[model samples]
Target chain A: MSDTSRTPTEVDDAALIERARREPEAFAEVFRRHAPEIQRYVTRRLGADPAEDVVADTFLAAFRQRERYDLSRSSARPWLYGIATNLIARHKRIEVHQLRVLERTGTDPVSDPFTERSDERLSARSVRQRLAAALASLPAGHRDALLLVAWGGLSYQEAAQALGVRIGTVRSRVNRARNKMRKELGGVDPTSSISEVHVRG
Target chain B: MDEMTQLDRLRSEIPTPELSGAAERRLLAEIATSSQPRPARRQRRRVNLGLGLASGLAAAVTMGVVITNGDSGDPGQTPTVQPYSMAAVTLQRAADNTSKQEELHPKPGQFLVFESQTMDPVDSNNENGHSRFLSRSKRTVWLPVDGSSLDGVLFMEVLPPKPYPGWPLPPEAKQEVGTRGPDRLADFDQRAEYLRTDYAYLSSLPTDTAGMRKHLYLELEPGARADYEAWDRVGSMLAEGYLPAAQRAALFRAAATIPGVETVKKSEDAAGREGVAVAMVSTEAGERQEYIFDLKTYQYLGQRTVVVDADKAEAPVGSVLTATALLKVSVADSAPVVNGG
Candidate 1:
């Protein structure tokens, strides 16, 4: 995070946001920097159709609220993610339904377009289905915390910031979500199953 | 094998999709539009005045006594005519012509769309200190029939700007030329009730000349300034507000009675349409505010503000401060949705 935040060619998101208040076109830089990451996060939760709209609204809402941004936060990742998470909460039904569909049918509507290799699909199917069931069964807050840490690649503190919760709350939710996933997988080592498929491949 | 690892692999194949062109355009458009400073509350009244300076052009002219012609020394010469009589004759003709035009009957849930072109002075204070230029735009506003300005939607295309007569064109002026919004028309509206131009309120206004005249003067303190305010109200109504023909006729007839109104033989709208105009001088501002009407049809063409006193307006006499052409008004079933939420 420190290294990415200090990339030589990059301007601090805080500086861009500050300049945007005076020169609004400067906001396009902030959008160009973060939109792809935010779009993928949204697409993973909801499907592609709604991701475009959600991402657009997230940046627009952030632009409107830019004046209130805290300049002390040099990186805008947590702030942008926070807005995207709130917007994703609006599509909770879609997220849960997609997860349940993947668990029951062994086909991921959210990822179908990107799964190019049949061998990769075959190897990951059982484990993927179990993971989907575990995810769908978790409470919304627990699910958000877990995904922010695992899929979003946010640290524990970053997940708490993104979710607007205390670090302690994020820690507990992730722990509880992990325990639920282990139970759903029947306490068996899924790696051994994957290793057998790997050898066959 | 762990839950976090399994979760990480879930939907992990989904690549970060590129931002679609349409979405990027929408964001860029919004940013470009929002960069233009919103008109302050007081400036909004000037916009409502339809003079186009409502964004930031300060009303610097001071209010002064109307200089009525006092000389009657030349009895042999044609009797000096009061400005009001000529203005009254033109307005009455407009009233008669308006009564015959087809009227729009917008329902409560519909929108009254107003499309117009405007050029007004924009004042910017930044690292360069104070600089001024003429900002021009083509705008379409969708105002809800029953709600305040807060419920309206605005779409504007910024045109290349011109220099504000003696002032150089500010560099920032060129940076904002492009399309913006189907966004909210206003952040908030704190207008007095009588000033509302919502179709619902306009439709309910008194449709008789006497009552309409009273409506224009509502809450105004009596004086030459009050008369100017009443005349200004007429400009506001004609600028963006739609009225049923009967009320429109009454408004025209009422406007004709404002104390200092005089008919200007020649005037041109922002779109360059030539017409006869009825004008009133704001003695304080040293400018003449004119509302042009088609010569034969008597239809309202547009409104403009021209400097009449060079020293007071701080511009050369005859220099135009603001001009607007209201191009079209129609009823729409809905406004365009830009938020995508």
Candidate 2:
């Protein structure tokens, strides 16, 4: 994993975790390494306000459980992601509510600031709305599986590890979730239309 | 044009946020606290060492009130003025004396400088399990007259560590025996506005007894917890807080009316100045929170927490868990230059 591929002088996550067990101050390094990505993931899911709380709590919980970390996995990404996913699960209602709002309004509250002047935003509105509707309608477990694979960029194996599910379960959930999204989009290639609009623009 | 690609395009513009500095500091503080060793057995009592800033005190004050069975008498009942109660008499005298004392008037551009000494429990762990000791320090704080705790500057010098009554002093205890920074006191101040101790806020407080009593119980749920919280508020205000003589007198008068207050004829501050004290017992923690006063002058001396029940407090009876003596309070035009700036 990219996280484990550190420079020769740098210590890996496992060594940092071991050091933190003795001198708790070393845990600050772990936070400094991954806080940005974790904060972004949580903000994407739960907006800005609750993301602050969830991200802080995730790191604190991770620090408390550092002694139990499996050192065999050199990368702390999966472990940290798993902890964040669990904390995000507590805000399931907020996530679904946000998605439903986007689906109905065709305006993503979470992405408004970033897409305010983007060239492709207006052209891709319908596709974004359909995707939001499909995502909001899926079973939470399936949505978790699909997003862990898609947005989180976790491999199926890593997704399974993060969600504490069997690899087959993650595979089936992602397949089912994709089928549902395809049906919601009327079996059309939504991304193709957006890219075509982008070409014309 | 797979579903996964379409999903990725949705809300893909949501930028990655910078982790908030406040959240980072809170996490670091939590880690520092957890690094300290705690008792092997679960601690039923909440100890308010009043060690850090007001944010820490706000949380400790809230948790210090543990609900006890029937002993609280009736919940939410307004405490009747027990004119003959020794605590009430002593507090009234203190109020009279406070009203006559000269008060410092800090302006908005100036600062309120507070100097004090404190002793609080310090716990740590290593290959050997948890170890506990008392960490003593002398602190001088320069707080802006009209600003949040974030604007405050603190300078602390660590004193030699003492054994926590029965516990042995660990070798690591002496590691921090030196002077620390005149750094920022708090990274963030999430304390509610009513809990503010800045000179500007304190000056705006009501200067009448009934109004002060009502302020003490502001937003507090009606019950024994409210009474204890009101008492805690008084301590927070008196510690590192300077008020005008009018408000100060009203505070003492209002504090006397809190339920469960009693008189301790003899009490000693962290500075070892023996004085009379007004105290309230937290039956849950089995400790009495005392606010000491000079016997003859009736001047406010300091505050301390003494164990009243060994089993519940996890310490011998009369063991002092934490103590503080407010050495001085003065007005300063500016804080000393820190970091050579």
lDDT (CA) per prediction: 0.72, 0.71
Please identify model 2 stretches exceeding 4 Å from their true place. Answer: A1-201, B1-84, B126-128
Q: Compose the digit string of candidate 1's lDDT tens values, residues B46-162.
A: 422332224212211111211111131111211122377888999999999987777899998999998887766665533243456667777788888997666677788887876
Question: Would you list the clashing residue pairs of candidate 1?
Answer: B61-B284, B61-B285, B62-B284, B63-B284
* lDDT per residue as tens, model 2, B213-249: 9999998889987788788888878878888988999
Evaluated against the true structure, the overall lDDT of model 1 is 0.72
Candidate 1 iRMSD in angstroms: 8.8
Candidate 1 Cα misplacement greater than 4 A, ranges: A1-201, B1-82, B339-341
TM-score of chain B of each: 0.78, 0.77
- Reported per model, the fraction of native interface contacts reproduced equals 0.58, 0.58
Query: Candidate 1: what is its chain A TM-score?
Result: 0.90
